[model samples]
Every structure is written in C-alpha cells, then in structure tokens.
Target: MNRLADKVALITGAARGQGASEAELFAAEGARVVVADILDDPGRETARAVGGEYLHLDVSAPADWEQAAAFVRESFGRLDILVNNAGIAPPRPARFDEIDLAAHLRLFDVNVHGAFYGIRAMLPLLELGHGASVINVSSIDGLAGVGSMASYVASKHALTGLTRSIAIDLGPLGIRVNSIHPGIISTPLVQTVGPARIARLQRTVGRQPLGRMGEPQEIAAMALFLASDEASYCTGAQFTVDGGHLAGPYREPPADPDETLD
Candidate 1:
C-alpha cells in the first residue's frame, strides 16, 4: 500500500545507517523523499538510489537549516514528514566525571539541537502539510539511564523532552510529533566500536528478552506508522523498538531439578 503516497518527506543523516534505511523505506512507500545530510557522496548516492532529491544539511548549523528550509519550500511547496534521524554515537561509553564537558555539549549540538533546528526550520512547510508528522530518532538511553555514556544519554533525554513539547505545540496546527527510541541495533555505528567493544556491547545487551540487536528496518516501520494517516491520533508519545530492553531486567527461570521421564 502507498501509505505515504504524494507526501513529501525530509530525512536528516540519510547518508547511511538508520537514516539511509528510513529514506529507502519512505521512498518505497511512495513519498517524495529528500535525503539530507552532511555526508555529500553517500547522501547523493542514497538520493539517487531512491530516485529522490538530496541536500547537504548539517543539523548542527542554523545557517544550513535556513538553506534547507528554502530548498524544501521551493522543491515541494510543503513538507509532510520530517525525520530527525541524524546523530553521533561514541564507540564506547564515557563515565560521568570522565566525560569532557565541551565534548558532551557538542554531542548535544547534534543529538538534541539537530531535532530542534529541523522542526523550527520546517514549521512553515509542515503547517502547510497534508498530514504533517515529525519523527525524532532518539535512543533507549533517552528513556533510562545507563552506567556510562553520560553525554549520549543526556542528549537523547533532551531530545525526548523536545519531542513531547513540540507535539503539543504543533498539535493545534495538526502536525504530529513523536520520538523513536531504538535498542542496540546492528548499524554501522554499532560496527565501528571494534571487535572487542562489539563483544562487550553484545554481552551487555545479552540479558534483554530478545537477546539480540534490532534492525534499522524495524525502526523505519515504526516511523512509517506515525507518518501515515493511521497515526492521526498518535502524538507526544515515546515508541520503543528495543527488543524489550526497557521492559526492565530479564531474569532467567530456575533450573528444573527433576529429569523428565514422561
């Protein structure tokens, strides 16, 4: 079904990984997708693959947003869906005190401020949209605190709050806003942690009920639902696709003492 037929979508960080997956999925669903990112080559490639357009957008830069807004306005006349999926993830988590204050703020620049910029810049277009929706790609860290990764966690939390506030603010205009929190997914960001860190991360997530990472497509599916008219009443909500990671601690069942003879 063409859930997004005739809708116009702009997805940030669509150069690769989750953003790329979202771009592909949106295009397949009949939306005129615009793959936006700072990565020039892959951004263009993703757009080409989807038979859509591309723009060089640095989410952390206000000026870039201005330009992006202009471009989208000129190209599509209005925006239907905006996915703030661009963000940075460190290979390893940083302890609270060990976290560099400035570096942490930079993480906020992208992870948090990026979403802020996207919504503000695209507000006009969204206001003129048919069934406008905003999807902020936060992480599981946004919902719960982690031992390390202080900066990343904080940024995601800020984003989550931003999502709720924006949803309420935009609701009057019929624009829906929501957040997507993903679990340890098998994305390029996950692969960059090196073999040792990868193994450690795997063990860390082993206790989750699903006992495995999620796929980018899984996250895309959730975003698609919100973007479509099916979610007309859904807003200011937190959707988790974390393989039951936020379902609380998973405890193994006790071993059976009797040998089964029956």
Candidate 2:
C-alpha cells in the first residue's frame, strides 16, 4: 500500500481518463499527488476524491508549467514524479494530400512541447529528490504506423525520442524517464473522434489477440510500476500495453484436413 511512500507526484490531464486513473493509483500507493488540468470542475473533484491538490494548468503554456511547478515546490517542497499525460488526438487529416499543417503544429505543441516544459520546469526539484521518475504518456501509434493518424503518430514518435534522450542525459542525476504507449483505451477523448471512428477502432481491436480495448486502470498500473522502486532498473524504455495489438499477425484457422487425420 505504501509503495510510493514519501513521494510527491504531479500529473497533467488528471481531470479524467488515464490521467485520473494514475492520480488515484498514485495517491493510493501513498504518494502526495497534484492533479493538474485546465478542466476546473472535474480536476478539482478528482483531487478531492483522491485527497490530492488541484492546480490549473494549460500544458502548452510554458508559464503555466512554471507556475504549476512553483506551486508544487511550495506545497510539497520537492517533486519525485512527473507524469506528462495531457494530450489531444484530433481527427485524421481529411485527405492524404491535404494535411492540416496548423493542426499538426498544435498537436505537437501539446503532446510534445508540453512534456518538454514539464520536465524542464521540474528538473531542479526532481534532482533534489531520491529516485525520481518521469513518465510520459505516449501511444501505440508512436511506435507503429497508422495510415490516418500521421501527425499524431509523429508527435508521439517525437515524445518517445525525447524520453530516450532525457533518460541518457539525466541518468547521472538519478531521474529516470520512460514512455507508455496505450492502445484503444476507453475514454471521452476516444468518443470525441465520433461513433463511426470508435466503431472502426472497436472492430480493429477485437481482431487483436486480447480481443478487447484496455481500461485506464490497466495503464495506470503500469505507470505506478514505472514510478515506484519496483522498476528501479528501468529507464528510457517504451512500455506498450496494447492488448497484443502489436504482437504481429494471428495464425490462420486450420483447414478441415481433419477428414484425413483418422
């Protein structure tokens, strides 16, 4: 129950979904948690439920990062974990040749730049703590190719690269960085992509070996492991909890050659 005893964690996008799940788990594990998000009502409610604090944070803004980190410092005196979980996955570009450059830039600003700011802002404080961990919420698309989500994939790929680079640079400081790639999680963000899209995703996921979409708590469990000493030897690694979606093709059903096999 006290796996994260004495640790303080600041998680972005903690108003709901995987972010909220991680906040709940971290708090349950005995860490003081700070739930940061732009959704005031839900964020505050989540914090209250978990006995944590809520901070208004817009991840794309460097000033917001600075302010949130400062608040964490004042409230907790030190930071031991930072979960960069805030992001948006907009609809795929309308046509192959008609990529929305502006949308792509905005996606990167939040998915990639947000994590960068979070890490940079918390570096000093993290350095002071013992065995600090930085967990960036990426996606399976980051590691694999999906025809429709070019820009989203690119942003996640960049996040993965950033995680590896920081892991190398911060190893000496005792701060570990890693990325989690969640696939087909059930969240409001998924619903925002529309019913047809969600149905397609469900069908595609059903073909997976696990044959089901992942729950937010499943991802939260992995995040907690990475943040705790249980994963002390892990760093700069990409963890995929994608219901066997990446496990390659399934074996075709055997033919009825059974007629010959007496």
Candidate 3:
C-alpha cells in the first residue's frame, strides 16, 4: 500500500466508471483524493466511501473549474496528481452527416475542453507538489476511428494531441504528463446499452487477443503507475490498456467440409 503516500489527487468524473475506480485505488494507496463530478449524490457518496472530498464540478464550465481549484488549494495545500477522467460520449449511433451538430460540439466541450481546463486550473498546486503527474484518459478511439462515434473519436484524438503538446510544455516544470487508451472496458459508460446488449458485445471480446473486456481497476492500475514515483522517467507517452484490440484483427478461416487433411 501507499504507492501514492502523501499525494493529493483530483480525479474528475470520480462518481463512476474508470474515474470511480481510480479514486478508490488512489485512496487505498494512501493518497488524499478529491472526487469531482457533476453527479452530486453519487459523487459525494463515492468520496465518503473512499474518505475523499467531493466537489461538484461541471468540467465544461470555467467557473466550476475555478471553484475546484480554490477548494483544492484550501483543502489540500498541494496537488500531486490530476486525472482528467471526466468525459461524455454520443448516446446514439450516427453517421457523420446524421450526427447532431450540438451534441458533437458538446463532446469537445466535455472531453477535450474539460481536460484543458483541469490542467490550467491545477497547474499552480501541481507545481507546489514538487513533481506532479497528469493522467489523461483517452480511449482506443483516440488511437483510431470508430464507425458511429465521429464526435467521440474526434474529441479523444484531440486529447491525445493535447497530452503530447502539454507534456513537453510541463516537462520543464517537473510535471509529467501522459495519456491512456482503453479498449472495450466494462464500465457504466459502455454499459448504457443495458445488460443484454452488453452480453452480446461480450461475445465479440474474443476478437481481442485478451478475449475479454477490460475492468476499470485494470485501467486504474495504469493510472497508479503513472501517478506514482515509479514512472518518474515516463512522460508524453501514450499507454494502451487495450487487450490487443489495436494490435490487429484476430480471424480464422473456416475449414472446407468436403476436404480432409492428408
């Protein structure tokens, strides 16, 4: 335990999914975590469960971010880790032309712009921490495109670029930055389709070399490594916890019924 001893971490979207898992794990590892999310009740509960603080933060709003920054400074004195895990995805499948323009714009507001705001708002405290780490949770879509998620793909791709650019900018300041690309993970974000639909999707997990969807804890483990002193030399890097989904397509041709091997 105590992989993150004496660290103060602010994790956005900590009410659920990968964010919640990160908060739990960070606290277990002896970090004082701040769970920030728009979901008031659940966010507060999650914070209470983990003995962390909950801040009601709408990541897209600058004022909310300012308030969060103030709270962190006043409550923690210094911030050692910032996990930009809060994000939203398109609810329905849509071709590029069929996609709603407003929703598409909103995607960037939360997924891309929110991350920027987090980094900007927390920089002061980060510097005070001596050597801080910033973890941006991108997706497999960030590495490649998906058929129906045009806006999500675009936003995550932008996050990957943002991660790289800022890593170089912040490296000199002793703040390490990196992005994570998660494949078909079993999170509420992906479970919105309901249990039955999710079950069907699980069948396709075999297509990935790991042959199963990833768990939120699996992603949290990566975050811990990046946030802790263990990864002091790691920065501006994109880590893939993708179950080999991006490696390549796994396929096997059918055998001919009428043919026999000699």
Tell me each candidate's TM-score: 0.94, 0.94, 0.93
Candidate 1: which stretches are off by over 4 Å? Answer: 251-262
- Candidate 1: global Cα-lDDT? 0.90
lDDT of 3 by residue, 1-262 (tens): 9999989999999999899999999999999999999999999999999999999999999899999999999998989999999988887778999999999999999999999999999999999994799999999899998888898899999999999999999999999999999888989888897777687667667656777899999999999999999999999999999888888886432255474433
Global lDDT of model 3: 0.92
| Local distance difference test values of all predictions, in order | 0.90, 0.91, 0.92
Shift in Å, residue 13, candidate 2: 0.7
RMSD of 2: 3.6
lDDT (C-alpha) at residue 109 in model 1 = 96
Clashes (N, CA, C under 3 Å) per candidate: 0, 0, 0
Residue-pair clashes, model 3: 0
Prediction RMSDs, each to the true structure: 3.1, 3.6, 3.5
lDDT of 2 at 197: 85
Residue 63, model 2: Cα distance from true site in angstroms: 0.5
Reference-based TM-score, model 3:
0.93
Per-residue error (Å), model 3, residue 15: 0.6
lDDT, candidate 1, 1-262, per-residue tens:
6999999999998999888998899999999999999999999999999999989999999999999999999998999999999999754677889887878888999999989988999999999999799999999999988888888988999999999998889999999999999999999888888988888877757667776788999998998998999999999999999988889676452246353322
Error of 3 at 149 (Å): 1.6
